[model samples]
Every structure is written in structure tokens, then in C-alpha cells.
Target: MNTHRTAHRLVSRAATAAALATALGLGAVHTATASAPSAAPLSVRPAAPGPDGGWHQNGLHLTAAENKKVNGFVARARRAERAISPGVRAAARISHAELVGFDQRLKSPDSLKRKVATWMLESPGQTVDASLRKINDAVRFTLQWPAGTYSQGVRTAAGLLSAWGNDSTRWANTWNRPTGYKAINSAWRAPRSGQLFEVQFHTPESKAAQLETHKLYEEQRLPGTPPERVRELQEQQDAIFAAVPVPPGAERLTAPARRLPSPDPARRLPAPAPAPVG
Candidate 1:
């Protein structure tokens, strides 16, 4: 099965990575005891529209009308993104510095259009502005630490919330689990622009599992995927994540209390790649 093959490859890769790190004069690889570091996500420029004047990404093709809708959202998202990006990146850098120890990187700017497009396509009938607002992870960051420092990672996430609060950033939610998904996924609104962004906290094990399951999940989400095939893919993801040990007290993690309900009713699960236009 693919899962077993992935596991075998991961084990082999982890061994090679560790040995390479030592030989390169780098110290111990910073990751969960059981995991190897996954490759960083690649950033790519927006592709030209497909032959039909529609958009094509990862087998998801949008009609000209859909493409127009998608592009509108993309433009607005980009404007909002530009206004908030500097402050957000600074906050991430400072927070990680203050908290100390973890692997960190921001989502690439060029990746936003497809991300916004995919979100809009998955949820039809929502207006472009409302849909743009609902889009989170436009300026996301992932922080991964060793499993041994699980509690410390939890504390850092809390510390980030507290510090961002002082700077007037409002957070919408925090999901920490072995429950919904393996990592702690949270959305925060930028101080002045009010654009929503995500910050995820993970252990090396969960990160590796995420890396393994990401493509599988994206494929599962594509349109035209048979229901049974979708179920099978979901099961594959579930099994991979089921193997990641949950951090102690992870369930106790919470976002700062909100006075009004979240503007976001429920943010949908993130899909790193596009779903087909159905």
C-alpha cells in the first residue's frame, strides 16, 4: 500500500538526513525523535490561463466565468495581503525569536491566487468580498519543534497570542488536537488591515505526517474523485495521522476569548493544492 511505502521511504530519508546533517558539521537535526524534516513548500508564479481562457492548476480547470470570479478574489486578497504582510512577517520573526527554537517559514506570496481560487470554487454562492475575508492562510507560518518540547510549543503559541493582542491583532480560533487534525491551526486578524492569516504549531512527527498526507488530501478533495476513492484517501490520511503521538495537554490549548462570535462561521480545512472545477 502507498502508506507503507511512504513510511519506508520516510524512514530511509530520515536516516540519510541525519547522517548528512552530521557530515555537514551541523548539529543534531531539530525534529521529533521519530521524524525527519520534510522539505519546505515550494513557491511558484501564477500560471497562464488554460487554452480555453480558463484557469488550470493541479488538474482543476475553471471556466472563463469562474476564472474571472477567481481572479477578482485574487486581486482583493492580494491588496489586503500587501497591507498586512510587513507587520505579520515582523511579528512572526519576533515571536519565534522570543519563544526560542523551532523551524519557521512563511507561505509564498505567489501561491495565494490558487489558494483563494480553490476556496471560492469549493464554496460557491459566497460573494467575492465575503469569500476573500473567509480566506485564511494567505500569510501563514508553520513552526515545528521537537516532540520533547511539546509543552513549550504550546506555550509559545499562547505567548504569540498574548503578544499579538498587545499589538491589537485579533485571533479567531485555535484547533489543537489529535482530534480534528494533527496540528494546532489558528487564524489571526492583522492589526489594521483585518486580513485573516494562519499560524500552525507542530511537532516534527506531526509535520512529517502532514508532509506525507498533504498530497493525498489534496487529491481526495479534487472534483471527480469517486466517493469511494475519496473515502479511501481519507482513510489513508487518518491512518498516517493516527500514528503521530499527540502532545500532552494539547487539548487544553485555546484561543483568546472572543466578545462576539467569529466573523468566520467555521473556517474550512485547508487544502494546499487545487480541487478540479466540477
Candidate 2:
């Protein structure tokens, strides 16, 4: 039975891979973490199509079951290209949904919140730096089975690009890279409901950052740390615990997040990437 299940899983993964290859063409596939120091969690959710004709959602709570759902969602998104041809913007919607579902599933919100805050506060680079750190942290945690929302965010981001062709430039901005590629990150937008936040990093570096971050988490958790070292780790954990963002609907969680500046018209551009005439 186990063998059969394993085979099934392999086949599913292969199918997904084949679909991605067909969609992305010869784009480089880099599965390493970015070089940024801090990152912000992209928060979004699902709702009626926004001004740009993309689905939107909020970023929060996730579960393992939802992760699978996200995977399924990506596969369907790829298939959608043939019919809806939703373009990168539509793909953006699918990506955010998968991630929001994942983040809400996390068991370590406090830890993720702390790491995100620290990265956002102390990181010396641009906004992308903060985003990269958060993405890495999220990816690392997700690998642990019942991982956190941040982890799911990483997965969702990669899946979006893989399933939907995007402009490279916008994707690069999400990772704080160069500004040449016409990527799908431009199609992202945030809505007031649902899960997952829309942001950038549709490039190869974003994927790299996720893989590398997972390695860091494994190394830090390696066995046989000195007592004092363990204490330090514990302290970091405690700090994170203190900084968790209370879920929006949680009765006990109440605090105001700084308001984001109004988005520019350029960021809200509505040119959907129409499919090639087949």
C-alpha cells in the first residue's frame, strides 16, 4: 500500500513538473535562497476580481491539508491557462490563495512573526530584503510538516511562477534583483478577504532563497548544542512568541498594523497578459 501511495505521489509530482515546464518554457530554474537579510510577509486574500481583474486575499492561518489544496490549486491554475488564460494576474490570484491557506496552517506563528519583525526592523537593504527573509523563514518552517504560514508563502510564490508565465522584471523586484525581466509579480494585488498576500519576487532568486533558508533551519536545529547556546535559542523563541500578530478574527489578538501607503496607478496597471493566439 505504501509503495502504491509513493508511486502515486511521484506520478502526481511528475505531471505537475511536466505542466510547469510546458508553461515556463526554457526559463532558468534556481532553487536557492536570496541574499537579503530581512523580509516582510505578503498578506492577501480572495474576493471578487479587483481593478486589475485578479483575485485577492488576506495572508493568515494555514494547515497541511490546505497545502495539498494549494498544490492542487497550482495544477489547476496551469490547466486554467488553456481555457481562462487568466494570464499572470489570474495566476497571481491562485498563488496568493495557496499561500494564505498555508500560512494559516502554521503552528509557529510567534516564531515567524518575530523573525519577520527582526528582519524588517534591522535589515539594511530595500523592501525586497525584508520580503526575502520572510520567504526563507516561511519555506524553512513549511518543510517541517505542520509548518507555519510563512513556509506556505514560499511554496505558493514558486508555484505561481511555475504554473503561470510572468514578467521577469517584477519577479526580480520581489527578490531585490535587477529590473529587466517581464515577470508576473506585477499582476499581484491585495484584497480585503480570503488568504495569502500579493507581492513580488517572481524570479529564480526567490526560489533559491527558499531552498537555502530551509538549509539554515536544519543546521540551527542540529543536535548537541551547548547549554548556553540552547538558552540563547530559547530566548529568541521567546521574543518571537511576544511578537506574533494576532489573527484578524482572534478575540484576544488586537493591535494596529501601520497602514501601507496608497498604491500608485502604475502598480495597479490593468494590462492582463493575454495568451498567445493558438
Candidate 3:
């Protein structure tokens, strides 16, 4: 695999995911119930004019109705998550049976919005619609294990997810050796809803590095960041990742497709429903 290309792709995908979340206005509020009041329409006040006398924001601008639709979609997604959590948790436990530390969480609306905004600013011409169609990280988990067990732990987790509901065609296991950010990311397409949710597996050290680099990544996304500063931030991240020891067999981890048992579909979590657009 082309490590550089893979790294760039991973970064792009991560940005797109955030942008989709923001477009859906998922970060604007907490999950709502079916009977909750409809979201208030976004203000039509124009964005502050840029130096070029045009709005700096350059992406698919969502309409009030679309935002409302996104709100509805988020609400439905939350409900679906509740239904699927059990199976996912069970699979995670089995995947890291030997590990005593891990963390799991659904992506918050606020974080998603920030990522979306950053991507929109950086890639002005891209539409987030397609990305929004399949929002993965809406649900994710992180596994924390000793450095020596990282490879074994991640491989086991990936295998379990593959057997559960991971769509082989959409599976991605990207490792950022420079930043020590390794993840077994995949799309789990629930048979019923046909919605794809994301699962991520990470080692503890890698997780810590990811958190530390997040702020730097955000700063690099700012409109007027100096190129030198960007490079500096990257170097810092590289230094951190360079210190993380690669466990045995980690370099060869792959997510080969697996066929799940046909008789017990309910053993997996329900799939997400496509987000509705008004």
C-alpha cells in the first residue's frame, strides 16, 4: 500500500465525515425525541464579508428545511444506536477480552460541526452530500492495551467486527506510524435499516497521540495559518508517533471479508437509516 496516499486519504475522509455531521446540524443540539419541538430555522443573516468582498465559507450551504430534516435524521439515528449497542459492545468485549482498558462513545454534534467547518474551508468545491449519506463515526469505540499487545488486540477486534456486520467492500484499516494513530475503521451495514455506522479500534498510546494532535490539526485548519507553523505542528506529531513502539504483527493487519452465520441476524445491531432531506 502507498503509505503517503493512504495517510492523505485517511485525513480527507476524516475531514469529510466531520463536514457531513456539521451539514446535518448534528452538533447544534443533543439528540431529540420524536415528540420534541422542531428545530428553529437557522438565521438568514449573512456571514461576515471576507477581504475579497465575498463570504469565506465555500461549501454546500444548507437550507432551513434541510437542517430540520437533518435534525430528524439525528434523532432517528440515536434511537437506532440504542438498539444496536448491545451487539456492538458484546463484540468489542470479545475482541479485547484480555484488555482491561477501553473507551466507547458516539460522536458529539459539536465536534462534528467543527470538523465539517474545517473541511468546508479547506476544500471549497466539494459537496458534503455524498459524505453525509454515510455517516460512520456516529458510533465508535477505542481499545486501550499495552504497547506489546496492540497488534493482537486490534486484529482480534477487526475480526470480530468483520464477522458481525462489517461490509468488506467499505473496510479501512489505516495506520499512521508517524502519528501513532492506528485504527481499524469500517462501515457496518445493518440489514434492516441499510444505514452504515462506523466502528474504530485503536491502541491506548495511539489514542492518546490522536487526542494530543487534534488541537494542532485544528489550528492547521485555520484560514490564515502560516505554512511554517503547519509544518512545525506536523513535526511535533511525528515525533510523538515515532516514539510509539509497533507491536509484533501490526504491520500485517488486514480486514479480510468474513461471512456471518445466516440463521442469527439478530445477534448483530440494527443498521442506521439514511438521513432524510426535506
Best by TM-score: 3
**What range of 10 consecutive residues in model 1 has the weakest lDDT sum?**
267-276
Candidate 3: residue 196 lDDT (0-100): 64
Ranking 1 against 2 by lDDT, winner? 1
**TM-scores, one per candidate:** 0.59, 0.21, 0.62
Candidate 1, 1-278: lDDT as tens digits: 99545533433333343234334443222222221123222342235666887767765455676666656654454455444433333333322322112222334433454555566677786554555566676555555656666655455444433333313244432234333358777677755556566666777777788889988987876766899999899888888888888777665655533333223221121111111123
- What clash pairs does model 1 have? none
Segments in model 2 whose C-alpha atoms lie over 4 Å from true places: 1-108, 116-189, 194-196, 200-209, 213-278
Q: What's the lDDT for residue 184 in model 2? A: 25
Q: What is the lDDT of every predicted structure here?
A: 0.50, 0.31, 0.49
Ranked by lDDT from best down, the candidates are 1, 3, 2
Per-candidate total of colliding backbone pairs = 0, 48, 4
Which residue pairs collide, candidate 3?
Answer: 18-116, 19-116, 27-109, 195-272
Q: How well is each residue in 40-113 modelled by candidate 2, as lDDT tens digits?
A: 12331222233554222222222333333333433332233232222323332333322122222222333343
